[model samples]
Target: MSDPGFRTGPDGVRWRDLNHNGVMDPFEDPRLPDAVRVDDLLGRLGLDEKIGLLFHTVIETGPGGSVLDGPGAISKTGTRHVVVDKRVNHFNVHQLGPAHEAARWHNTVQRLAQETPHGIPVTISTDPRHGFSENAGASFSAGSFSQWPEPLGIAALRDEQVCREYAEAVRSEYVAVGIRAALHPTLDLATEPRWARQLHTFGQDPQVVTELGLAFLEGLQRGRLGPGSVACTAKHFPGGGPQADGEDAHFPYGREQVYGGGHFADHLAPFRPAVEAGVAAMMPYYGMPVGLQLDGEAVPEVGFGFNKRIVTGLLRDELGYDGVVLTDWELVNDNHVGDQVLPARAWGVEHLDAAGRMELLLEAGCDQFGGEECVEVLAGLVADGRVSEQRLDISVRRLLMVKMQLGLFDDPFVDEALADERVGTPATVEAGLAAQAASVTVLADEGGLLPLSGSGRAVYVEGLSAQDAAALGRVVERPEEADLAVIRLAAPHEPRSDLFLEAWFHQGSLEFPPGLPVRLRRIREHCPVVVDVTLDRPAVLGPVMEAVDAVVGSYGSGGPALVRALRGEARGRLPFDLPRSMEQVRTHHPDQPGLGDPLLPCGHGIPLGARV
Candidate 1:
């Protein structure tokens, strides 16, 4: 069939002849059904091309958003080598510039893809970028887009509409600059209070996570896949919480995800809603499920990425999710960037070589390998008859289907002018600010210290700037000279200096150092203190709870939003239980919900008038 998208060559050959058979293939036809297009494209792809589709690695852009030539922090391979020589089309972009520049770079990259034999349009994906935190491996800070609270903050608001609106706003900014996939809306239940990555998740409740995940997917995808949509990869599937001893899976020590409560089903509950909502893709976590029993059988104690019982047997067969399944980054080969050498997160399959790991993941039903560019290894597997070419077609079809559904085949280039105008619009900015204000959870309000009068009152502040204090009222040098002390403290973590990216995880003991508590006590004694602490994860708040006259739990609010929160202009309830002490955290099950005595429970928030 002659497809509409194909152009006739000068010698009567079809320009969109993907198979190079001098004819317009069904995949080249825009008018055909997606199934036909995907099947046609999949059948025509060589082993090398198919292998390329399986590797979705990171790429870094230059300062002006041009593709980098050499190695960088996030990626070991160069842009041209991966896209052109290596034949990988899908990329997870890191550290982009202004919208227009990003648009230009995207177009430039698209031109590279267009030069290929198949000319498949590149699919650019990104992690959460419209939030405050700038953790390089996790999420980017809101640079060109409107800044909002983290997912935890949105959960704290406890408003489905706000979650939907936030997703929509994020979609607008992402699509503006050619970002086709959102590597987030982390559906992992934050049951383990001390898990470092909990900031990205909604909370402990499966219902709340499900609702928020649905809302987020609906907003980002606009209820369907098309040009305007940012395909949501609802992540850390089968749930990534329940880390034994509250450790993260990103490191060797935190490699085991133990379900001690025998509530594996509880962790899997949130994913059902995501599947029902039709998420575009799923990302399995790195941790191996240690001694997790499902359906009266023990699941293979392997990382979810390479576990057939989980990805294929459960997520694919039982729940019936046919979408693309991408593994978490660097699961095959060890990554050596600069002085740091991050071992491959193969988990139980650590004994396997790179080729063995790739073959195992393929058999385990992972369609794509995130943060890996070793397409040659997969091709070698096929050549050696360890992995089948027929098996490659299955994943390639899924990948092509997504590309077609995203409207990438029709037109992948973005308009730079529109990108510049659309990103960080006034409406989105206002929406972000509003959400930020609403995420401020007031934990304590002793003696009516909150809703502190803003006019003509001398303010002593820490963490918050003196200039910001001046905006509220008067700024005083010392707490003794002020009516009240306005302070800000991040949720404390026992700092880790080992390994390159270990410090960024923020795992380990969630307690304040002894000196911090003593200093806070002294400051509180000097004057009545109104403290706002950013809760990236649940913290042991025993000392802060005791020393401050009032404590406000912040997810990711700005100076203005913090001021609003202090002045009673903002509102939010706690998303997770704030444990009273480290001892309480120790006694609680990592997988179970609502255990131990909470200082302030989830859904605890003070009303504006109640404090005054």
Candidate 2:
């Protein structure tokens, strides 16, 4: 095998000789302008290589941090096939064990890319991972990363400084692990109280969401896209809330995002700040707009990824955002994992074939397709003279520009040893722990029963382990034998185990199971019950609130943090309103404020010293 080469320029900066021509290409020269570099690189790529840049699919790594040879959970194409044979340069990685392990896997992926002709360093991206939730389809737990509160928890504090601190910590962890793109800072407004994904958003108010969103973007991007930054993708573009009856967009039944409250522009207000903050990417949601009137014209009831009017007209032309626009995952091809098959979220364009869907996405101004690997479908379109190479270049340029802006071409490798030092460092973990403590909103406390002032009382625990409960006071097995009972409960969701990915989504009615009310009543009968419900969604806590002496809303908080919150060492405020009943949730406009006299309104929280 020949030695595939390097060249030194006049300025003494050695270029990779990416084209292997023994001459320095414009794209290989770090000194060249990004536009010239992108153009030069684009010119050297053939049709297959250009199509490869558009697909960003899921990639799984082995226990040793090497690309797996067998099929992964999402993609049928193996790592080698995707990187070498298929020429894919973008991957959304999932399920790596530790920080150092993920870093090693990332370097391995990059090394595989280095073997390609163009030697384009692969961009690794992930959904929100530095959080408490472990939803497989949505987010990962803080495995080796510093864990912070959910996005809603950050909003509850209502402090941009905290958001900045959190983002900086997340940025450091992400960069250390070789994740150059953060697929989050989900700017979707929590106006829709029952939306499953609201845990990922800053809460209801457009103003507050806008402020925190900007701060988060500034922190992640480090005020610009460069070597030290993880490019933030502020998403579910133009806002994904206002779903009819709080149904999410991930399923067929929840495919419509409506604006019945005439607040289309309000939903989009947060993105304005994100764009102003120079977020590197925008991700359109999977839902199609249903009879949404914007700027005196009705938006077509097509999915945002296929809606040219929304993507090109609204985001591009109206808002003046030219950053890379990536569609939410799996809109082009149906995902078949083992025996179960989930249909593509082609939503309004469901009638279209894969080629038609790709054409619509391109026409809608999407630069890349998320969770999709159908490069052959696109290549066929170009071959048939239906789609032009000129169209392909438009997205390819944006994609390459993002890579250059992130300094991926200059240096994509990370120090594997540094990953251990930087990820979940003492300082980062401390900050996260503090945030967790701060975000535990004390929603309802009857007769000031909180701040569990005096310890050594007999305490009965549920949900939390006995050892963890012992820290507060004497732990008891039975509620009847205790002076006080502390019960922990996650917010209720109707379980859907039909589809493979549906279980990951915590959707459906917020009402608790029929047996839960009976159990809680029995517990409270013995002693004053202190209930802490983890508020992933706005849980319908009417029965629990009615029975318990105190109710606390926890968003991604830990056992120690919960104990601290109970002991009055920290403060929290409600990020969004909690409705009184499921009836109100069904009837209320998804975009409006205050859901028919909420049990606890937004910004309602009791500090340790404050009177309840």
Candidate 3:
């Protein structure tokens, strides 16, 4: 029955009467039907079920060959605690819709879960999910998850609609399968150039990040796919960049967060926008700062996820953000071989066991644990009466409340086939192309050296394969292939030595591959050169730019916008400033300057034809 107080007029969904109280409630969901399964479920559960939802666990299940492994593993387990047995819930295990084996395996788990007593369908998620790649162990998925040009690749477009389109494309793909949550839209302000994860951010501009991030969150959740409306998590709060020595905080030893730069508030700014936009969740960074707060009392905080002052106090108390707070994966131990990973100490109870840790996380204000074994530990604690049933009930309720708010019960189903309709659809592909085009920056084209009228006797290219040079209407083994040596560059990642991409951070620093300048110089010596920096960032180019007739930052393989820039179809502007030299990056805000060098300032898009 519609509530008499609710007014559902043509205000559209965003502005609709969500509270059913005859008026609009912008971000709040319509008053729900209690969805109080947690209270009753908690009452009925012997200490066992009470602790189940406390932790998001990763069991000893292998990649198990796509989502198909779930069923086979579940049947083999032969344990009641294996609730929906073979449908064991784990992220990145499956959901590759195109792979015949992956799809079959995903469906098998779903079928088995239906037969389960409680039918708790496995909650599946992906880093990105549906795309050309299904990379289980890397920075970006290879086989699935639409790989829209990494956020930095698109930040220069400065078009929120374009960002919204990309988000919608991701949403469409995610909703097809059962990925009701996206651990993405990383809004962490990457205030440092040396940081490895910097490319994942939108850019140096907070306004751009906030607006783009909010659009993405709204688009992902707006569709509200059944069982859950793919929740968007804006991540690594209090900023993740500026890691001391560019190390990650995923390990215990790397957990100390330093705030030497006076821009912690800048990092915090993007998150407030996320909260205002009504995103489904947030991920606290693994880092904790050793800095003293305003009071002069030593406030070296714990990891943001487990810090009561940050989670419950700042996030919940001051800003009033109430959503699921998932910790970054494996927040407890370090996963590296020969790096600094040590036991953590700070902020919370001095001596803590597994149960004690879970207790502290909850008390400090986080709602769920991710990539950890808190579930089994919490269950064991309850069985031993160390954690009370009442305490467990509070957490379970909060988790279930989110599920209900996402309309999961009414829409609990995943289409093993709807994936094709979303993955890199025309709109998605176009967005990718557009981002590629917008990313290029023409640092300097003195005397209008660009818009090279196809008058070169022979156009040569460098670093470009002979095949690619031909695509640009020429040939090239080296720069001597033709008169115009267009070096279409690609930033290489640390090759997957062990099949999975580990230590996944590149310096994003710009130093030409040894003697690339010599090659460009030799080409410059022969003909007017067109050097296309096919990288997203502007490298230390004092030598290269001087030698070349023209230099264009194609921004990673000439994104669609970048390609357009070269063809003189679009104005290639630098969205962020590039340092004129390396020393500039070193002296002025070396630790966390979002823009490394100012060779080309933000918004300096050069229009080759407007040569007035």
Candidate 4:
């Protein structure tokens, strides 16, 4: 057999000689059962190669979708160093270019993997990218892909079909670029209004979250995992909302997750549907539990990724979920970028070294390490008698079985021309825009102040582009000279600059700053003010709602979508309640839902022609 060898079977079908043995192996034959193939391939893998299958980390693409030749900022090493030398086959791809170039990059990486010893195909995964959010640690902005509103927007409509369509769009775009796994459809219920990661959740209602999340899971996996599907990883198992002080667990300051109101069961309610539906994967969050008791047992005070009681006992044994369990990013190692260092999210087990963390995570029943590439650490554990080779085989078998089921063993490359045609097509773009328009929640319209009539009326705007606002009416420099004032405000958060990733998360204090209400009052004195607030998380909006003639809540909708909603072209409802004051927000328990007096309740909305 040559370096790149192929063998013809009795049926005249060509198959890659994965082991280069000149014989058509069972793993190489597409007609064989997936279980038989996985078993055959698993027996052939060496210990170090099996260790590589347990790690999935970030891989950077070069300029114009070329493979990185040398070390880069994110990846910290060259492509061949990680792919061939390290024997890593799983990758999480971020910062992609145009569709055709991204497809070319995918094919390039697959070809590189084909020449390796066993010819294992690379399994590429990604965070949610088809939305307006652009946090580097979380999600990316929809660059060339079809753009839609946030997951909160999909939940606001409360339509399962719409959620399915949005997920189907995401699946189509991801599959075109050779992405096999989707790390999203976050089932975390947004019970804590101040949590920074709420934009990706469904809502506070467990029933709504369960129904819509299952639809989204089905859409992405296309009824089952196969060649045409992008496997969905329903995430943050046992829930990630209810952070202490609503701060994210990405930083050290927000490491604790408290269930003071005894609502842990409510938070765990949504994940049952995903488990029952046979979701392809699960991701435990980075937050550690504090004084939490589940089913008459006190859960260990560790991050969910390192808690065996949570991952193995609850998710696997109790829920009967046999899917792959992937830990959230960077649970085992610290991340250093430029002049800053983010310590490992070991949480309660901060004293352990990298190798100790790997051993504990495997014992916790997780299958793969997210955002980590320390194959040497895991290999050393095996050598030191801490981790047995049989334990390594368990995870490797699960990982390889997923790759086979996704049809990556048969063909992993994608057509560049087809990717260009399928991604961000006119139909997908229109559907996304329509969903964005439909997700606009009209909270208030006092005395019928919305649906502005003619286009010639003078309009004054703030926080909106002049080009997009021009479609409604003539743009004016000041509110005094215009017939109406349109202001776009983001739900408030106290800014923090202490940590590197903390600044990106909008945490602490949903109250509006002191000057905002006064500024809105001044603008309203000159002309009737209509305010649109982007509710990534629910806000305390009593003052602004009182001053403005109309208040509309937007869940990541763009300028054009807002204009369409204001012009009576779309309709939406509130997904969660808006607090009346900071006092109310403070007094309400973070883990409980619908327990306090709110300015506007969930499911509250005023239609375009209706008066509040």
For candidate 4, write residues 183-286 as lDDT tens digits: 98899988888899999998888888889999999998988679999888888989998888888899888889989998998889989988888788999999
| Evaluation by lDDT, superior candidate among 1 and 3 | 1
Per-residue lDDT of model 1, residues 272-337, tens digit only: 978877889999999999888888899999999999999999999999999999999999999887
Name the candidate that leads on lDDT: 4
- Model 2 scores worst on lDDT over the 10 consecutive residues at 1-10
lDDT of 2 by residue, 1-612 (tens): 223245677889966766667677788888888889999999988888899999998889887777888688766778988998889998888887787888888888887887787988899999999888877567888888999989989998899999999999988888998999999989888877778899998988888889999988888898768889898888999789888878888889999987777777788899988877788999999999898876778888899989999899988998888889998999998888889888999999899999999988998899999988888898899999988999989889888988998888877878988889999999999899889888888888877888887677999988888777777899988988999999899899888877887887888898988788788888888999899998888988888888788999988988887887788855778888888888888888887755758888888988874632
What lDDT would each prediction earn against the true structure? 0.85, 0.86, 0.56, 0.88
Q: What is the Cα-based TM-score of model 2?
A: 0.96
Once fitted onto the true fold, the runs of candidate 4 whose alpha carbons sit more than 4 angstroms away are 1-10, 609-612
Candidate 3 to truth, TM: 0.80
Please say which candidate is ahead in lDDT: 1 or 2.
Answer: 2
TM-score of each: 0.96, 0.96, 0.80, 0.97
Query: Can you list the residue pairs that collide in candidate 4?
Result: none
Better of 1 and 4 by TM-score: 4
Error of 1 at 389 (Å): 0.7
Looking at model 1, residue 77 earns an lDDT score of 80
How many clashes would you count in candidate 4? 0
lDDT rank order: 4, 2, 1, 3
Model 1 / residue 259 / CA error / Å: 1.1
Poorest stretch of ten by lDDT in candidate 4: 1-10
Off by over 4 Å in 2: 1-14, 609-612
